[model samples]
Target chain A: MFKKTILLKDTSFSPEDKTRDVFTRCLDYLREKQLEQDIQVVRVADSGVYGQGLVMKVLPDATLYVNLKDEDVTRVIDAAAQNKTIEGLALKKAPKQIRIVLRNCGKIDPESLEEYIATGGYVGLKKALLELTPDKVIEEMKKAGLRGRGGAGYPTWMKWKFARQVVADQKFVICNADEGDPGAYMDRSVLEGDPHSVIEGLIIAAYAVGASKGYFYIRAEYPLAVERIQKAIDQANAAGLLGKNILGSAFSLDLEIRLGAGAFVCGEETALIASIEGRRGTPRPRPPYPSVKGLWDKPTVINNVETLSNVSFILLKGSEQFASIGTEKSKGTKVFAVTGKVKNSGLVEVPMGITLREIVYDIGGGTISGKAVKAVQTGGPSGGVIPVDALDTQVDYENLQKLGSIMGSGGMIVMDEEDCMVDIAKFYLGFCVDESCGKCAPCRIGGYQMLEVLKRVANGQAKLEDMTVLRRISQAMQKASLCGLGQTAANPVLSTMKYFESEYKQHIENKKCPAGKCSALSNYAIIQEKCKRCSLCQKNCPVEAIPGSREDGFTIVQEKCIKCGRCLEVCKFKAVSKT
Target chain B: MDKLTPEAIDRIFKQNRQQSANWIKVGMSTCGIAAGADEVYATLVEEIKKRNIQVTVKKCGCLGMCHAEPLVEVCVDGMPTVIYGRVNKEIAVKILDKHVNSKALLNDYIFDLETK
Candidate 1:
């Protein structure tokens, strides 16, 4: 049995890996010293550290040694064998991630209510029901500074307080699980991983607002999440946690799941309420907000999956603990579904004040293609793009909003150099255009027109005046749209145009796509000097754009090429070039 | 199975706190299942039964490391609890054979995430 383990990784950018070489050398040295059985040496895919030549982490201790040389293998093995540390080589590592929302994600059996309870799961609800009054519960939320995580950062306590103060016989709480962001899955993960937590949070919210009924507005697309939440509700009902007289307190609430038909606009509060009410899922103006008039004309409190998840923890651990984490205004950790061009793409829960750089590099392990990250797209279509130069900006409600991006639903998509800004803006704008309910003309018509202009820009057919037209239309849509969906639909275009206007200028003036992504603006050609005259490009071109024999080197016919990139992909000698 | 009172919740919490000393938890959420954690989980259970290993195999949810799905966390008496990622049937067998039986940690498979 080995007493200690050493995880080794060749973190060098070189294509050639040195982990095997170093592993063998360490094994041989340990075997020669008759300590092979005492120390275990292993090669890892990622050592959690990057760009350093070679990294060796000794565990149980987790002392990382970076830029290790071949001779240092003996010293590492020796240190492990003797249970000592090499002061000069040892490196201290601070944890870059904190898990509050995902606290019991991998720890307990989610299917078993007993396991969740054992891990202090429903204890928050128990405390809320037994000790705290409705006002006290709202007070705790206010002290915790918890905010809604459904793209909008409204204070959770204020939403509950408004619903509580309203003189209504019937009030409701809805857990917004209708996550429709392109790359965000934080809600789905939480609901699937720990359904009870969200349920507990919902129950806590229901209790705080004096509501007897609650609903989970989940998208039908997330079958797994829906199934898990259904099971959780059933379990809670069985355990007397859901239906009538919950925890033997007078505050009894019934919770049910409502499936959304995969409409993006239905994620809005008013639209969600409309969907639940069997009405057409379209948004109306908010003044008498959902807290005052919502869901069958009754006061309702809508909290996001992430927001409710924080409620249970805050009630259980006290407001101080929850408030202590994150920036002053934004308390507790925010879970982000970090995806798109990232190396370690997954769900990361970080404190609110953590920098985007730390989240992208330290936690995400940088981009997947080993290319520098160009920008990060946050808040889905409603949010904006944050350029790489501003990566040091702290992440919070105000900070992201100040950076022209809302903290929408916590979808942080890391984009590398190959991703064209104009193309990305067009993709998000197109999503909003397709999802527009057509109730409001600004979102219905404005989104379509903006997308049309973006298409023209992408196709390299737009004039310099078109940029001004795009901005003018975006402002009009932002100001005239009746609902949040239409109001924020232009955010992606506005943000991309703000940060990447030069790329748009390149597309408009030079008729060139800097990222080589927009096929409409791309031109493909055969580099005559590099071509081997092997007929490979000619044989592979589906359009027969490359026409010539092996003797007479192939040339690309530009009009027939279609810019499919098949020739570029099939070319062996790097003969095909795209501009 | 009745409506839990505050006292009952406390009792259940206390009773559940005393977890078994040796167990293996497989992440079984959508992300984990998509990455074939169900197969890995089945293999671990069957292999443990076939070998009559004194270890318990259970299912849990994703640990936020969706990239390293099919994560298998092993916790045995006198062994440091560690999560092995990208696990499959073969690795499950190796885990039971080498790590569980001989008390040796697998080298490259352990994913040491800083979740503190």
Candidate 2:
């Protein structure tokens, strides 16, 4: 058996991989020293470090060495064989990701309550029930500085305190699992990976607020999550964790699951409460917020899946430990479902103060297409786009809001150069328009009007005055919208226009999409010099836009051209040009 | 099982704290299952049983690496615990034979994700 393992990868972007060459050289050196059996050499798909030259990580003790040459291979192998470190070559990369909410995600069996307990799960609830009072629990939350992860970063302690102070005979707690963001699946992963944690959080929230009943408002779209949560609730009930006299404490709470019909607006707390009440899912004005009046006209505390997960951790490990991580205002880690144009599209739980650059490059492995990243779209439709220049800004509740983006449900979508800014704004605005409940005019009519103007801009038919009209309408919607959905619907348009104003100007003035994404603004033509007269473009054009024989040479008829890009895709000699 | 008191919870926690050192965990969440983790899990179970390998195969949830799913984590004595990504039936067999039985780490498949 090998005493030590060395994993190698050619991290260079060159077409020819040098992993094999490095591996062979290392193997030969090990053999020469008669240490082949002692040291194991292996090639890896991803060495966790990118853009460096050939990279190798020595295992049993993961000491990474990067930018390696063939000569360095022997030194790396020799160092590993002796379990010694090479001074200049040994690279120590501190991990960018820290899992708090996702602590037991891959560690224990989520379905098994015993495994969860073994991993220090539900211990938080036990402590909350046995040692801490309702006010003490709120104090711990306040000390932890935990905030709601559902777009609006409200203080969790204040929400519980408000509900606790209200003189009501019947109070309720709801776990907002109705995650409706387009690219965000952080909640679903947590619910599926560790359902007990969320349940424990909910029970603790119920205990803290003196509520006897709680509900899990989950979207029906997430069947797996729903199933897992249901199983977990049953297990908790069986173990006397969910039913009356939970952990033999007087704070007994009954929990139930409510399925959403997959409406995006229902993710809002008021709308979620409305949906649970068997009413139309639409947001109402806040003042007598959900903490004061919610679900059947009773004081209710609504916490997000992530927020509750943090609560369990904070209660288990003291408030100081949870508060120690992240920025001052936003404590603990935030889980982001990093999707769209990213190399590794998955759930990443990172501390609040980590930079977007570190999350995108170090954690996400950069963009998938190997193109330059233009911007990152955070906070879903309610949030805004953060330009690449501002990517170095530390990610937190206040910092993201300062960048004109809310940390909305942690749906961070990375946009590369090929993604059109105007088109992206239009897409997000269109999603809001479609999901608008038509209750308030600001969201219903204003969202539709903004979408119409954005469509005109994308089609290259809008005048310069239309940009002003779009802004005016966006401001009106932001000011007058009755609910969070309408109020923040214009965020995408406002933010994209704020950072990518030049791209919009290009679309309006030059009638060109800089990203070449808007088909209506794009025109295709056959480069006469480059064309081989092979009739390939002519044969592939579905609209019959290209008409001419091989001898005559094909030409694209502009009027008939659908701009489908089929000719561009089928062209062999780089004859078809799109501008 | 009855309603667990605080003392009972502590006892259970202590009792289940000591886990088997030699075991294989397959990511069985939606992301992993969608990426064919179920097949990889079945293959590992069958192969280990067929080979009579002294290892336990179990199912867990996603480790946040969805891009390289069907993730299988193997931990055996003398071998460092490693998570292998994009695992299939063939890799499962190789893991049982080479990694489990012979104690050699597989190259190119280990996803070095920092989950601390």
Candidate 3:
């Protein structure tokens, strides 16, 4: 067996990589000392930590040495050889990815009830059932300061407490697993990975609220998540962790699965309740809220999948420990589904108040195209774009809200220099318009008018006054919409307009798409200086847009050119220019 | 698989506190499956059984590094536990042949994370 494994990387900003240099030096020294056989040196791609120049991690020991100079290299090698840590050089990295909601994920076999239980899965429910009273469970939740992770960030304890205090014949609890955000899949992963944790949390919620029945409203699109959750529910029933007299306790809660017919609007609490009640999945105005009047007009509590997942974790690992992880207000970690232009797109669970710069740059490993990050879009279609300048701000409910984003279900899509803000706004606004339930006229008509105005703006057919019209529609939608869907649907348009006004102005005044993303506003042309007189563009155009011979140097027929971007794609000489 | 009471939960957790030795876990979540982790899992299981390898293969969930899907984490008796990312069927066989049986870590596929 190898005595030491030295993992080295030159994580410096300079052009030269010193990882190989250090590796050679360490290898030479080890060989000279006749200890090469005992130690193995390997160059690795990612060391999890970044920008800490010439980083070396001695594996098995995991002793990390950062900012290594030539002199410190020898000392680090010696320390690794002796299984010792050099004093000042070794940094005990506080773990970056804190797995709380995802604690059982990727570790235990999700299908195995035994595996989940072995990982201290339902102990939280056990604690809530046997030791703590309903009031005490609510108290513990209040102490934990946990909030709804389904974008709104409402206090979870408050929802449970309100549902608990209501004097109703029968109460209901619903787990909103109808996650429909375009790029977000955190809830699906949790449901698929550790369904027992969620089942336990939902059981705890049922017990705390004195509810006799519960439902898992999962989207039909997530067949795997549904299967895993169904399996987990079955396993829990067999183990007495779910259904009647759970774990031999007095609390008898029956759990069932409700499949969402792929409606994005059903993610809203009221719409989800309607879907569950076998009615049209549309939102009704809130006065009694879901806590007082929900599903069959019985007092009910609706918790998000991630929020319920956190419940079991918060209870299992004490409220105080959960409270200690994040910001003062937003306790515990929040999972974000980072996608789009990001190098490493995945679900990352991090403590609240962690900077967006750290999330995008450090955790995500920067943009995939290596382009300068233009802005990061958080909260999906219902959220807004955060300019690269504002990326340094900490991520929490309040902070993201202040940044004009709501942390909507933790879908963090990164945008680079090539992404046009106007186009992005139009794309998201279009999604909302398509998904609009039409129950409320404000969301239906207002979203359509706003999208039309955005379309005109993108096509360079709108005046600067259209911007005012867009803002007017946005304000009307936010104020008069029936539910959260209509209320926040204008967020993307408003946010992109707010942060990237100059890009929008360029389209209106200069009639130029700065990012060249709006094809209508920009036209492609073959540069005479760059063109190699090749008939490639002419041969590739479907409409036969180009009319000239290869020897005569072909040029695009402007009137015939359909702007299909085929010529640009077929051109290997980099001759095609979009202007 | 009897209905577990409070006592049984404690006993299971106590038993699991000490991790099982010589196991390979493949990420079998949707993201992993989309990237063909299921094939990797099947290959490992089939090959391990065929070769009569002592290592136990198990299916797990996504570890959040989506760019490197079909990830497999291997832990043997003496070697350091390492996660091999972007693994395919070939890599699965190679992992079994080199990493597990021979106890030598593979080159150019380790995606270790501590934190940023």
Candidate 4:
């Protein structure tokens, strides 16, 4: 086996990669020195660092050297062989992503309770029961300043404190794992990765609020998450953490898993409570909020999977410790599923006040296709678009709302130049319209009308005056809708119109899709100058829009073209053009 | 499975922490499993037992890097703890041979992120 290994990747913007050449030269130099058998050199797909010319990581020593020149290859090999340090070339990487909510994730065996306890998982719950009273638990949460991570940004302490104040024979706490956001799955990961953490958190919430029972309202779609949580509950019960006086105290609580039938509106508190009571999952207007009157008309507390996971962490690692990590207003970290055209798309937990630019470029490694980011869409359907210019703005609860977006469950979708704002807005609005419960007329009717206007806008049939109509319907839905679902459903439409209004105007005035995303307004044609008599586009077209021979050359029948852009993608010579 | 008292939590914590010193953790969450972590996990277990390697293979959750799934984090006696991403069955065998048996670290696959 090789003694030392050097992993190299040329992360430059140039299309022609020089990693192979550099790898070969390093091998040649090692062979010349007769050190080839001692040291191994390999080319990697991702060097984990981008835009830093040539990134080479020397293993065993774990010395990272970036921006290497062709001449520096011999010096790097020599330094590694001699076990000498290179000061100028070493890159010290500081981790941008932090994990508090995901502390035990990937660290411990999630299914093993013994392993979880070893990681100090249930110590928080033990402290909450033995040391602190219900009021004191809420006070500790208040010091932590953790807001509800399930979109609304309500203070977690305040919610529990309200439920604590209500005099009732019985109270309930629910872990809302019904993660229905289009591209968000932070909850499922946490549940599947560290089910015991969530269970411990839910038990602590029950203890803090003086609840005798709790439920895990996870969506049926996450079968693995459900299975793990069920096993965790069983383990907790067997360990006397649940179904009795927990940890040899008077605090007795039982936990159950309630699976949602994949209704998006069930994520709302009142709707969730109604679903738990075996009713049609629909939201009821607040003021007799769930904290005041919830499941079975008794007081209830519903903490999201992410929110509760943080509770146990906050208690274990003191509230002051959790309080010190993030900004003044939005304390602690937020787990964001960074998806869409992003390069390194995954679940990233970053402390509040970190800018979108840092999250996208530094942590996410920018877009996958390496195109200019047009906008970063946050908060999913209920959130809004943030223009590329405002990416520097610090991410907090209030900051994002000012941009017409709530930090809705932390789904950050990066959009490139090719993604039309109008089409994107329509897609989100279409999802909300489909998932709308239709109990209230404003959401049912207003959402339908606004989607119709957006469809008209995409089809190039909308007028400048139609903007007023869209706003009117949006206002109606936001005001007259019964719950959070309808109230914020029009956010995508409103925010896209606010930020990318010029792109929308291009659709109306120029009768063109700026990104060529709206198929109704875009057309595809083959350019003869670029065409190399390739008939691949003709055979690949699903609609048979391109009908021509290789020798005679082909023309796209515009009327028959579905504008799927298959020809644009399949064309090897770059013949197809979309306009 | 006696109901654990408050003291037993601490007892369990101490006992499990000292259970093993060297092991390989496979990310077995939905994302990792979907990326064929099951195969990577099975291969590691089979290779460790077949090769009589004095290390254990365990399952854990996703490490937030779903884009690079089938992530395997290894902790050996001499080498620093490192995560290897996008690992397949072939790479699994190579990790055992090179990183475990021969006492050399894998070059391209080590994703070392020092957390705060």
Candidate 5:
């Protein structure tokens, strides 16, 4: 029975939360007017704006007003009660996200073909099969300016054209759902949320490239995504939309699912095809690219899960419409799996040119612990650490690359003050070394050797010259590694060294981990002054490292301590300290 | 199942695509299931049936918010369609009881991403 709804939030980083003050005033005014029943004012955790004071959103109209003064609460209540705008005080919030690829994600029932069709899902497949020719489809793609969403920003139309032009007896269109990036899963969500759209895109790609067979090279890790895709394929086939002759056209295509053995290298297209063909999943040198000779030495077209999902939208709502949303170079929306240390860690699909500040703060709802975000890791291990100062740099293939980071599979991990840069670098480098295929020397040997050097550095056993060795091995891997895996293996280490060398220097020179994350170089102890003879730290110590009871103030046995910080957390009195 | 022609596709789309009156959609993606969305979905279905609420319970894909897995989108007639993130059975029951039946938007759960 409420006539109006107002969303209130104090988005400022200031100590005092003005949200309660604003909410109380609004309620008081409404109660004084005896109109409390007519209006509902709710305080929200996030209003999508950061560092802006007293954000108020009037619902039904969704009129947002930001930076409101204490005096303006009565004015806001009066304006809302009268159903009138507050004129200049009304906040015009420009939407920070665009949803071309994720259009049907939260909106429709993904499992229902009828719901998908209602939302204009397979109309692209219908149009492609009956009306548009292969060349025309590629032409439309070119006009749309669609690029590959699989980190490498290759023009999608050119890849299609190459596959289409190749006169081959058999051609294949593969959906690269092998999203193996550490923090990236935009592909999985799209496949799960809007499976039909990706399927529709795959169908169109099949027709465009004259491919009768297609495979979805999904990783075994994503069981739900696999299940949803299987259900969608079944649904599509049952509806006669995917069989021998789809939509009654001569261009017949059949699709199948292939599970990856959870190898990160398999995300690379050549490695993906090799895995699908029942060969060992490893990247081969690309001489005759996948567009010409791929998947059993036949012509093949491989598009990422996201690129294909955009296909159906492009076909249904013309190429120009799809082209209109994003920046000039990177057209359409890019879905980011925004994770780590951030408050709203999830998938965010924004226009290509939107700043990282907008993405991290406006869309992602800022850092989780209310700490200053140190750096944002993009493109997974293959990408680099972008410091907060450079957050305003437009996110695109070229811009990210210019900042020494590639948009590898859209994994954006935000790191706050607590996360050690050197530790993070070592983790990624170790992942690459672990996942290295060992077919090539640079990736296999270089990745391992570099990881060893990083381990030595983190463990406080390496000299300054060892950093040179790390650099040399990294350069060698970048220049000589067979595939993208070996080539970008050194990114994490190199980027961290570039941005946070002081932290690394502290580890190596001072023999100290600034964040106390590297356990080998750090020690745990109890400060005598702060200890209130509490037995809590003594009891909770897993190793029984604290050798005293409450009678005598507890002291940590340094040798017995694993530096786990168990005592530090267990101590109510500020007794335990790690150094 | 007839092979859909362009004309038939248009007709079927128009006839079938009207907005549903009320429903609960749980994100059934890998992340969501890992966060116990299956149990949530099953509980929602079972609870709605037991309560005899005239609303449909369905499963959808991840809405790209994997951090808050087990996302639930609720759209009831005369209520604003809002997505509730990090939903468990307790929150699901609250969503059904408060949001659906009582017509009140739950506090601290609605994720209003301005998706265009």
Candidate 6:
């Protein structure tokens, strides 16, 4: 039998990689010692540790050694082979992520109800049904301290408790899977990967609030998730996990799937309830929140897919266990769809209070192009930007808000130096404008007007007074918009103007895009010193903007140039430059 | 077909949790499928069955590693569990032939996360 295995990776941010050569030498030394078979040396793609040279994990034993040298390999092998560990070389990396909601994701077969049950999946629902009353369940949730994983970190227990306290003949529970946030797909993955977990959570939630029915408000964009969830519901019904008398208990609940017609505003609970009730997917005033007067004029509990998934785990493992992991205010893990300019762009379920630097550098493997990360955009279009300097800030509800950004949804978009702050703001603002439901005057008109002002700034046509106009409109939208979409429409612009005001000023006053992202403000030309006078630029110019001959030395016509930078690609001597 | 009692549910849960000595799970989520996981899954089943390997081939959801799409995780009783990424038909077969059947590690595909 294989006794031990050593997985090696170079997690060094240092310029040189000495992993392979050093590993080979160590392998050779081990072979010379006739211990090649004793300790299996495997080179891994990632060791979940970054910027530490020559990372090696001795598995079965799991004695991690970092910053190794030529001499340290033999000692590592000897100790690892003997089932012993060296003290100094052992790496004790604090896990950047703490998974509760994603506990079954990639661990169990998503489609297999049996596999889910075996992993103690439905035990939470079982416990909630057999042991706890509705009040008791709410009490446990209150202890666990789980806020919604959806944009607003509202207390989960409060929503349930309020709905439970209300005397409604018919109550409902809705899983808000209408995840339309830019760069966020956490809900989709949870639904597709562990459909049972979310299902079980929803069932427990229904029982806790005395709801007879639950509806999954999933978006039409997620076809596969829809398919998986449908299969799961079918399996649950077949297995008598749903319908009348669930798991041989009187706490019976009926579940259905309601597909959202891909509306961004409908992700809001009020708008989602409106959509479910067959009304136009727009938000009304929220004094009578969903918990008070929801679908069909009855009390309703709307929870994000991730939040419900946590319910089961908290029940199965106990609320204290769940609450112990995260920060004081936010007491659970948050799943971030880490995308854009990051090396490891994926879903990362990190506990609250973990530093943003740890999430981006340790878990995400830093920026994709190896450039210094400029900022991280969390909560999508509705969220504000966090500059690189504040990366060490703990990622909790309050911390993110303190940085002038809300943890809108779990979309954490990494931005490098090449990503112009103004350009980034424009992109998000444009998305909000496009997705705005146009129901409220402030959101409808304010969003369009803000977009126009941003466009003017981007086109190098705006004066500095436009900044005040942007602030004024942002304040109006923030205070007056009906739903989250309209209210946070100005987030991107306001954030960029706050953090990178100089960049915005540069675009307005000097008519220059420092990152050369804004095409109207950018100038494209060939650097005469570096030009090799290659005719490839002239041949490849789409608009015939480069008008000079190879003999006369190629030059870009400033008037005719569309700033497409075609010459930049064709130049072999690195001649073409854009600024 | 029958209303599951609490005892029955417990029994079913117990019966389903099978302990496998060795296995390979491919992330078959939409993100994984879009990145050509279907082909990889089919190849692994075919190759493992053809080779008469004892390792159970299974489908799982996204492990949150979307950038490294088409992720294939291998766990042998003897060796460390590793997630090999960018897997195709060839790598599927290689995993079955080399990682499962042989002792040597496959070149440049192994990703070892701290499995707890």
Top TM-score prediction, candidate number: 2
List model 4 lDDT by residue over B1-116, tens digit each. Answer: 78988899877777777656589999999999999999999999998989999999999998988888889988887655667889999999999998888776675676544333
Order of the predicted models by DockQ, top scorer first: 2, 3, 6, 1, 5, 4
- Residue-level lDDT for A220 in candidate 1: 94
In model 3, how large is the Cα lDDT of residue A272? 93
Quote the lDDT for A87 in model 6: 85
- For model 3, the superposed segments whose C-alpha errors exceed 4 Å read A12-29, A51-53, A67-75, A88-92
Judge the docking of candidate 1 as incorrect, acceptable, medium or high: medium
Residue pairs clashing in model 6 are: none
Chain B structural similarity (TM-score) per candidate: 0.93, 0.94, 0.95, 0.91, 0.91, 0.86
* Model 2 C-alpha lDDT per residue in residues A1-579, reported as the tens digit of each score: 679988889988787998887787887788899997888888777777888888988888889999987788888888888889899888878878888999999888889998998888888898889888989999999999999999899999999999999989999999999999899999998999999999999999999899999999999999999999999999999999988899888878999999999999999888899999999998888878989998898999999999999998998889999999999778889999999999988989998899999999988989999999999999999999999999999999999999899998999999999999999999999999999999999889999998999999999999999989999998999899988888898889989999999999999999999999999999999999998999978888888999999888989999999999999998888988999
What lDDT is reached at residue B27 by model 4? 95
Residue B51, candidate 3: C-alpha displacement in angstroms = 2.1
Provide interface RMSD per model, one decimal: 1.8, 1.4, 1.9, 3.0, 2.0, 2.1
Q: What is the C-alpha RMSD of each candidate to the true structure, in Å?
A: 1.6, 1.4, 1.9, 2.3, 1.9, 1.6
> TM-scores across all candidates?
0.97, 0.98, 0.96, 0.95, 0.96, 0.97
Summarize candidate 6's per-residue lDDT along A1-579 as a digit string, tens digits: 457778878878777877788679768877897787777777777777777788878877667898887678788888876788898778776666778878889888999888888888788888888888889999999999999989889999999999999998999999999999888999999999999999999999999899999999999999999999999999999988999888777888999999999988899888899899999988888889889999998999999999999999999999999999889999989999999999988898988999999989888889878899999999998999999999999989999988888887699999999899988988999898898888889988998898899889999999999999999999999999988788888888888888999999999999988887899988888888988777889999999988878788878888998878777876788888877
Model 3: DockQ score: 0.70
Per-residue lDDT of model 1, residues A153-198, tens digit only: 9999999999999989999999999999999999988898899999
Tell me the docking grade of candidate 4: medium
For residue A63, model 3's alpha carbon misses the true position, in angstroms, by 2.0
Tell me the deviation in Å of residue B5 in model 2. 2.5
TM-score of 5: 0.96
Candidate 2 — what's its lDDT?
0.90
**With candidate 1 superimposed using the best TM-score fit, by how many Å does residue A484's alpha carbon deviate from the native?**
1.1
What DockQ would candidate 2 receive versus the native complex? 0.73
lDDT of 5 at A115: 86
Instruction: Kindly list the per-residue Cα lDDT of model 3 for residues A514-566, writing each as its tens digit.
Output: 99899888787889899998788888899987888877887877787778898
The fnat of each candidate, in order, is: 0.72, 0.77, 0.75, 0.66, 0.63, 0.77
